[model samples]
Target: MSAATAAAPRPAPASGRQARRGGHPLAGTYPLLRFALRRDRVRLPVWIGALTLTTVGTLSSFTTQYPDAADRRAAAGTMDSPAGLAMTGPGHYLDDYGHGAMMGHQMLGFVLVMVGLMSVLTVTRHTRTEEETGRAELVRAAAVGRHAQLTAALCAAALANAALGLLLAVGLGASGAEGVTWGGSLLYGAAHTAVGLVFAAVAGITAQVSQFSRGASGMALAAIGAAYALRAAGDVGNATLSWLSPIGWAQRTYVYVDDRWWPLLPALALAAAATAAAYRLSTGRDVGAGLRATRPGRPAASRALTQPLGFAVRLHRGTATGFGAGLLLLGVMYGSILGDAAEMVEDIPELRDALREIGGASVTESFASTVMIVLAVVAAVYVVMAALRPQSEETSGRAEPLLATGLSRTRWAGTHLAVAMAGGTALLALSGLGFGAAGAAATGDGGLFLDLLLAPLAYAPALWVTVGVTAVLFGWLPRATAAAWALPVYAFVVGYLGTVLGFPDWTGDLSPFGYVPRLPAEEMRWTPVVALTALAAALVAFGLAGFRRRDLDTK
Candidate 1:
């Protein structure tokens, strides 16, 4: 090297302004969007494909099941009541009573909730999740612009919504179901995209507000829940309340009935406004930090936080408590409607025919069994999330530090597993009790509550099997841990949708939920429960053994 060249002049170190000279705040957004797409390739397709195929599958079932106008009119009674309106949408769709109107009134609202969830998670994963894992800081250190990450996240969400909307439109239009037009399908799909975009924007703001990724996701989901509640309340009673909710906007589009395109304007407007606000809020905080300040913790740790079990409790307490309360409320809601079960299904011949197949069970008992399937599936979701907590801990690099201090892998993972199992069982029981209590109050059947409570216990073994499957994935194929979710999704499809959508009986055998006897409807059968329990025990044992030998997610 020439001394003269070295001594002559060293290039000036680049200032922050100089480093940012080549691009605007959203520079590199396209590349980041592509990168985000790559990361979510598997997940995105699973979500879209599952939602689309199953939803379109319903059209055939509805067409075949209700072939005539008379049949459709008869089925219309199912959604005519207050409970029906709250669960579905406005009563106007019942006037036309076409399959398209049916999908718009009932299916559209339900699917929007799911679409909103997908959007929320996508935004949070790209923004808050990256920040939590320290990747945002690293990425920002490059030539990447300040707003690039968030813009890219939102773009990715937009892309997903766009794809979903397209698929829905195409699938429904091609199915040639009565009253399902390409134009109406487009409008229906648009409703989903609009709701999704609003929630995606909501997630963006929440991600900026909450320091923890989980907190951000929870906050956004709470917003989705609130919107649904507001819409339901408004639809059932108060005409004004529906106008306040984005979900109401989607429903008010009235696809296949009036096909009112104007209602979607407010949803789109909200999405735009929230997105702008999210961008503005991002400026108030530094990369990897939240706009909302964190409260200081106790100077000393609690004794309970000193052990693996206690630490796990501390980590999972908020989510567990929140979900438990939710399950109980859900159970109560289902129970309240149980006493009116006969009245609810009397005019709907399809339901009456379906119940007749159960032969001896009363309509109310049959109804309770159906409700239990849904409640159990929800409980399974909670358990899966809780069971996957250890993987979250390990991937965050926290597990290694704790393990370094003489903590055995099995003990730590086992503690989390224990929490998952116990929490799942408790959720089902709580929901069952609530269902039973509400049914008893509504129907004047005092014995209902006890029956319901004991009924959920029948599902405990099946939920444990889910936990064990999750454990196996986390233990051996940690990278494939997300696949554990397929179990619950499959269970939901077969257990609930199968019954309603006329999926073949053989399909039920494919899910663990099918093996268990539906509570209160059938006599208690210990053999299946016992067999499931033994399978769970074996799977759990094998998973733990694998975890004991495998390398941790962190060094």
Candidate 2:
């Protein structure tokens, strides 16, 4: 053939592996697995290490705090209540180091949540998100198989969970407490790993069914939340109900008490079933398409949706509604238990002392205040997420189109910021109402409604600080905005372990919540709240200025 008319480069025979791999599926999964690991190298290590450190710190504290037989028995007394059981796990003998095995009792629920979030986000990010961004199609255009992406996501989750399990085992076993045993540590680790895998599978299934990656993530997280709620309700009321939750299954392992390993079987079964379902579902759908179809919207936009601020509200309404509903339920659940708080304090001197140190006045006040504080902390997450919406919009190229028009960058970003701040504040207020209403109804004390409603407001400034911090990161360091999440995560850690781990008061003070009045227990302080509000406003102003100066990245 002449050089100019050379035979076109021959296409590989679309036969054998190339043709059959699509049918077989999972062919390119190994390479995808490597890609997942590389992407998650830092995130996985941070999550595993943080949880392991918490485990070590908690175990070490128990050894020091309950060294004597009498101390152990006294400590065990606090664990007997329905609320305690709901928060921790089934009761266990506290004497002779059995307590060490149940060290996870204080932290495991949160750890499960963390790991579950990790798994759900991982699967959704790799699958639906890739498809949403058109990256999956590009990858599939290569030698990739049909199911490689989903398989890699699940495998990555499994690997991360397994690594987390090993870390927990080593950390717990090395605590050097007289009650700590290697066998219990191993079982404990295995149970947590199993819990993560179960949620990973749940994520995979949701990813297959939900059209939007966001919807997939939401569904998976909702399932996890529902599981936790079921476990809590069951542990506190009916033991049989607990059987329905994967978290309950893990708790039933009784690692330190009986060292049972059977719970792993059910979790493994669930993981296998879910993964199989996902794979089967994958083959039925087209690339980038989901089992569920997006509902049609109005033919014309509403008058309110025409403006930037209205547009922000329209975008934020679903998220706001979700947060409000979840928090309201949570508040009601916590409030329903306040009647027992006083009795609990009377029965357990250790708990009373701890509450007093943290600013609990009466047991009821102390308990209610603590619960409200926790709700406040959770509310901050909504604020941070909302504040970061502009960043998401910008990166996704949605904001670029708006900014390219007459809309100024400040006006566009400000709209989302308003939603984050105002919506978050409103959610907290709703939470307080839910809590107060439920508590009053339960106790037949109508006076409680006012107290509960006003109490959450005390923490609003702290929540605003989180919103400000996230906005600051989004504006000044768009690429590094993810680091903003660490603030709330760290706040949760400090709030949970500060007193238990004997961290310096100043260390806890790093959390904005640390500055908020403990409310109901202590009289509300205005100075700190005002200072926090001023600081938050300043930060937001500074961030907006920075954002205006920077060029938008359309790519």
Candidate 3:
């Protein structure tokens, strides 16, 4: 054919092994698994490394802090207190305080959380998210069977979790703690891996039930959170609650203590049942649809959507309510726990000394200061998410519709930014109020509420700086919004982990949170607050100017 004539006929979509009929539709599973593995290599390794490092770092820190029997006994005594036990699982492992037992008891719950998160994200991304975005459609058009996708995703998560577990085992063994046998380390690692597998199966089932990726992921996360809470309550107050949570099962295995190997089998059995149910559900549901159909919304917008700001308010109302409620609850819980710290100190004199050393003032002030720091960190996260709204709307194509209605770009973007800034401030205030109220109720002291309520405000300037950074990124480096989010992640690493791990002063100083004066512990310095506020304002202005000049990304 002539060149022009040849161009008239479109080429067929490319095809390979997927075009073939096979004994098992999953014959091409290895290739798909390989592709997914390559895609996730960098991100997956970072998560795994970060989690393993958390475990190893805790082990190293504990070794230095409690090198001998007397130190272990003191640490165990402090942990045995109800307040500490409530916060950090049961104290059975702490009861026999060898280095291995001490480290395992203190850090296993944290490790399980990390493993569960990794598994959920991995499974959801590959299964529900892919189907939502229509990638699975293209794959399914091939010789791929329904179960093939789920199988591949499960295999990937299993392999990744298995590798992480092995790495953790090696890292623990290399730490050179006495009584830390290879078998014990492997069992500990397997427990975490099993937890991950169970969650992966849960995510798989959730993906089949929920109509959207967000709903699926949310369901999975809710399950994880509930499991943790149940386990925490049970471990702290009653054994009955522990039986209800998978996390409790893993922790109660008591690595380096009794070293019972039977608990892992339940996790494995749960994973198997969950996986089979997910597969059955997958086969029953149509591609690109869910087991639970989406409910219809009203045909028109609500009366509340009349103005730009009102619309912004409506858009953010759900998140604002959820975040506000969660922060309030957290604050109250922290506040209520504060009263018991003094009693705990009375029981463990070394703990009192430790608190005094780490926290500059009295026990009450020290406990309040620690709680405030945690609240600040969490509040900063809310600020970052709020500030990223403009970027998300623009990239997701929602901003184009608003701009097409003759709204000025600056005004449109500014509306969202305004909500973020104001909403963040309100959230911090609410958090403080919540904690303060809870503290006061618990102790019948009105002054405690005032102190807790004021603490979050002290950290507001630093929180605003993070929001400003996100705004600047949205305006100037729209393509790199992920980098903007990374800024807070880096700050968290330095401010929280750096302090706990004894990182150098300069490293901690790099974080804005580190710069914010610790309130209630030390005298509040106005100088840093003012400087941070000015810096935040300048960043917002710079970002807005850049945003005004840049062309809208209509695509």
Candidate 4:
């Protein structure tokens, strides 16, 4: 008929033994979107609450934390260095030194990165993950269209991003902060939405290209990390490099200061373009398969695969490898800045005093202690993700076949937990060494390397406690494996901010990580470490008992 109709997707052909499901390529998209939302109702709310509260708390605290123009201007000096620029955004905002500029320049980078992460996981969880677990095949066997699943996933991500953006806009506009306005706040929220949508589209393409769900997420996440680096370098050295990254696009918007809206257009256009490409690519692949076909396995099974631990390792190796490398590099980045740590806050005594209470230590060492929380919390994330993986296996139906052969549930599940434990420890060790080596080089002190390297190991018991919590959830409340993430998130907020902002001591005592002695800055204490280790062992033992008693989720 018309040009528009010609471009539209057609219904299935009415022929063959199987009757055609007569609808467009997006036939079941709305229903699928509703189902996805239903499944993530609790999860989505938690994400929204965390993001909104963090934004509000940080923005509100800025006024009280830096009450005068002199303080804000002095504070801007901390973000002037290359290391500072790499962590924050462009130096343009530093010129104004207002509360809104401070929030936008500092808050946007971290907020967008997190929003991107949430979007990537949401899409991968619904699309490739569902396909890998065979639920996509089952869903497709009904009246659903080929493009319906991916469409629903992207829609769900969009909804979450929209909600986050709305909350941020409302918070900033109504905050009564000196420089924040409704127009600027609206632009701020739009920037977040634009970045998130772009990442969700990136995840859609990655989901189609990767044969496995983890690979899909890893690819998208690597893209996010690369964007951050590119933007940082561009802001510091080359303006042109920023053009290559979506994050740079969002940052250039300069919300509440320049309040530029033109930069967001690129992000929105890229999101639309990538989504179209993902849909086009999906037409060439079958359900449960990817644009990248799975490689043929060796005809014979490896000796390691015959054992439970090896099988578990093989399943986890891809995710662990990617995440571990990222953590190590993050540690290096944090450590490389140690030489400049004192310079950043030299004019602000309040900021410096909160870093640590160590006697006879330079601010540099205290800075290391404050940042160690971020590194340890990141490692704990891996612990939680890997530890709860057994629940994924059980729900996917793969574990049942193995269990039927000769493996008991406890042995099979324990193998997975062992892998998680070893993998988490290895990740922490690599990060520690990276931090130590980088810090030593930056400061030109050989002695610091050994001390810093040994310091992180002290957190291993705290990490084991994280693994134990996940094990407890997987054992008794298998459906509540997602709850394991609560501890790490809480620990990050309390440990990082409380130490920096001089929060109450009991606030630090609430998390398992709170029990960890601030190494190098504080003398190593064995009492808390031993208690945490014992608690972890007890939790793991109790969890194993629960897992043994509970029925597996075959459906």
Candidate 5:
């Protein structure tokens, strides 16, 4: 052959077995992608709808809060400050009643975080999780290529993210906010889409490295959290550091104001590189194993390992530690910012008024109370994640073998419930302690520490209600266990935006968090706390009873 002909790309000759094995490396991806989409139909719509609603609701609030030119100008002055920039972003759209930019600043971090979460969970669930549960083995036993599963997962995530982006852009543009252009709104939506795609790629790689789905999720989520913090730190201090985080890249798009699109290029490149790495990594491992080998455990069981509750603790401890440490850091951040409460309130009259309605004694106390409540919501999320552990265990085929032993189904379920309750309560308490300690150190009011410490306990009952709901779902609606996540999401929406959206009192009353007294700002009420706790306990009992009556394997 001539040199030019030899240099041209050509297919390698196939051996008999190879010829019989399959077609192209990505031959089955489209079908698999469709299957994944089918599986995620309900899940994706809920995420997209919730995100869109949040965006529109935020827009509505901005319009109502700063309805005039003068109000927008004053809001812009405070938002441009280093403290404000750190909390939100550069306030690029703070001018012109910058409802679009203000919405971007207030909602971008939260929206991107949720998008990242959805992407990571979706990718990991289809890839490592399916493989771990032996579902992928059956798929692979068919005419599937090695890379098809991961490719399909990435494709599905991209589609979901795209849908979410479109929803955001269209929804916000129609929200009737003055001065909010469709172009900026599109960029706002595009930013989250890019962020989600980048994290989907991150999940692809982490799924290859992690031996279990939970670990893969943790790695991916940890990356997202780090990216968010890096950008926040960079925005506040060195602008250069923001470039290092994907979230920074999204925020740098400056959705409504500057509307730059260049930042998305790096995110796209990152996704491509990570997806390529995942494919390469997938080749060296067996169908179900990870690129990293599973470490050998102790040959003998410890005393703690002898019981179901202890086993539950061992399996869940890593995730709880991760959540607790993160919340502690969050507490520190909230505490450090309390000193700026007075200025912040003065600069933003809407917040000042909202705090007053919530019974804020002073700016500082109001801010603290808000932080505690927000932190409680965060804590409740952990509770839901923890409470849903049993479903994960059951789906992975690990529960059947354990149930085959002396363990009864109810006892096995109860152990996990106990862990969920204990772990959730402990995490909330630690978050409270961390918040209090940091606040006390800052303000030097020793009593402030004690007061703030007790604040989180009041929210525990509400969180327990969330946990109870998860358990009930896992018990009865095992196949639909994923829907349990919506409970927390709904609660968060109601708790965070109910007041701002002019929701009726009964609507807010639907959330347990709404029932809990806004501690330190409003006096504590025993009736709601006791009532919620009793309901939680009753739910747990009902869930255990349901689990006992059902088959061990819902599948």
Candidate 6:
């Protein structure tokens, strides 16, 4: 035999007994559902707990801040301002002017975003992502039906959202906020869950259409962004635009006010339609193949992949661009509202303290500072994304080929780490610039533009700490890299919720953001910023050293 013919082909595993006798798909739904639940047990609970805590804390804080009808009205008036209306939804729910209603309005969008993010991540990871990685094929060969995997994933996500909704309702009822009816709280929770289900269905469909998990997630997030835009446009201008967005549908529920039950029907119907489409598409595609065909690539590596740094840049550029654009938009919106902050503060005394905490020498400064903090948070998100790239590349086996080249492990890893650290800084600066420009445009003060641009840079050191930790984890505990992403999330909880709820001082201090001096509010305190930067440097060094010695996972 010829040498090429002499090599034996690997045998395919024997297919298990077909469970669906009549060719009816989804025969193994129950078993797949159970399996998915088992897989997501730890993850789902953590998400639910975090979301519940955020909602409950926000409610408690808002209620305490605005205890009386007059205060509620003042708060409502501030929200009805052009800036707040553009950022949050329309002032429809603000009419009642009660603490409960105000808290619900304040928290509804945040909760829905969190739940929807979790839903998309969880569902996509299990369904199309598993198929892309060939995990689903092995399961399918074991008697799992074609639709069983997707069904199981959707079921798991839906169940998680439902459980979270119930928990949120119960937690809110127990929090002792006045006029907080169970029906209102339940409606609020249900609205968020419904949004999550719709996103899960969207993720399912995107998974079928996108060849890669990242692409699937990006597409789903784009859809989410579109929803937010439509909602914002509707809320800022015409009421009809609100009807077009899933977020608007959820908000239209108006929890703690009218508590409309009917809006949920559309969300549920959308989810159902999306799920049905996913199943139908699944039947038409081969296992591990997406509905969208993969385009052919160059036979050889691109010029961009000639070096470790180049490779890292190529891999990370897309993510950086996306984050940068988001930050820029946020900054612009925030800047547009700078002139209105003084007006808002004059109307609402409760906002005075909040504004003071955010950093405003003047009303405009205070508002700019508040917007900067939010911009900082957004930048921090970019840091987390940057830090997570090491883990992602490692897990995806993309790092293996790069490592096999002449590149040292540390050098290769360092390239990505550097991009993350630097990219985060760049994103923060860009956000500040966008914000400053908008503020300057609004107020006709070019000086405000510089101030806004500088605000994010002030928060850079603290943000880098988060990125460093993730790099360290990627180096020393590659298996636990997933846990590294949780650090920033924890920081967010402590920084926002802890401060608002007046939790123990130590709780806020634990966050890197807490340690970082608030810019524009206080003069530069280089000690803490320098300390955080030092910590980040140390983490990077340790991570690189550790990564150099660790075995690369090819699987």
Candidate 5 at 78: error in angstroms?
3.3
Number of clashes found in candidate 5 = 0
Task: Look at candidate 3 and give me any clashing residue pairs.
Answer: 331-435
Each prediction's total of clashing residue pairs, residues at least 3 apart in sequence or on different chains, is: 0, 1, 1, 0, 0, 2
TM-score for each of the candidates? 0.95, 0.91, 0.86, 0.94, 0.92, 0.92
lDDT of 3 at 377: 71
Candidate 3: count of backbone clashes, pairs at least 3 residues apart or interchain: 1
On a 0 to 100 scale, what is the lDDT of residue 74 in model 4?
Answer: 86
- Model 2, CA-based lDDT: 0.81
Estimate, for each residue in 405-503, the C-alpha lDDT of model 3 and write its tens digit: 978877777777778777777888888998788777766777767777887788888777887888888899887665665556666666655554566
Overall lDDT per candidate, in order of appearance:
0.88, 0.81, 0.77, 0.87, 0.82, 0.79
Q: Is 3 or 6 the stronger prediction by lDDT?
A: 6
Q: Given candidate 2, what's the lDDT at residue 222?
A: 92
Q: How many clashes would you count in candidate 1?
A: 0
The TM-score leader among the candidates is 1
lDDT at position 154, candidate 6: 91
Off by over 4 Å in 6: 1-24, 298-302, 347-351, 357-360
Q: Give the per-residue Cα lDDT of candidate 4 at 45.
A: 89
Q: After best superposition, candidate 2 residue 297: deviation in angstroms?
A: 0.5
- Candidate 1 lDDT score at position 48: 93
lDDT tens digits, residues 196-223, model 6?
9999999999988887887888888888
Which stretch of 10 consecutive residues in model 5 shows the poorest summed lDDT? 89-98
325-435 per-residue lDDT for model 5 (tens digits): 988887776766566677656856676777777786787787787777678877777888888888778877788888889999888888887887788788878888888
Please write out the lDDT profile of model 2 over residues 1-555, one tens digit for every residue: 689988888877777756787656777889899998998888788878887887788777666656666656655675677766776766643333345645756566657877898888888888998887777999998878888999999999889899999999998877777767899889889988999999999999999898888789889999998888888888788888878989888877767777789977998999899989999999888888899998888999899998999999988887788889888988887777676666545644545666777775466777787787678877888888889889878776778888989999889998888788899889889999989988887667899899998898888887778878887888889877878778777876777556555577887688888888877888878999999999889888878888999988785
Better of 4 and 6 by lDDT: 4
Over 1-555, each residue of candidate 4 has an lDDT whose tens digit, in order, gives 878768767887767534444356777889999999999999998998898888888877787777788888988987788777887899999999798999888889888899999999999999999999988998887778889999999999999999999999998899999888899999988988999999999999999999789989999999999999899889889989988999998989888889999999999999999999999989888888888877999999999999998999999998899878888888888888887888777776666667646432788788887777888888899889899888888888888888888788889888888888888888878888989999999889889998878777888898999999999998988888888999889988888766555678888777899999888788889999999999998888889889999988886
Clashing pairs in 4: none
Candidate 3 global lDDT: 0.77
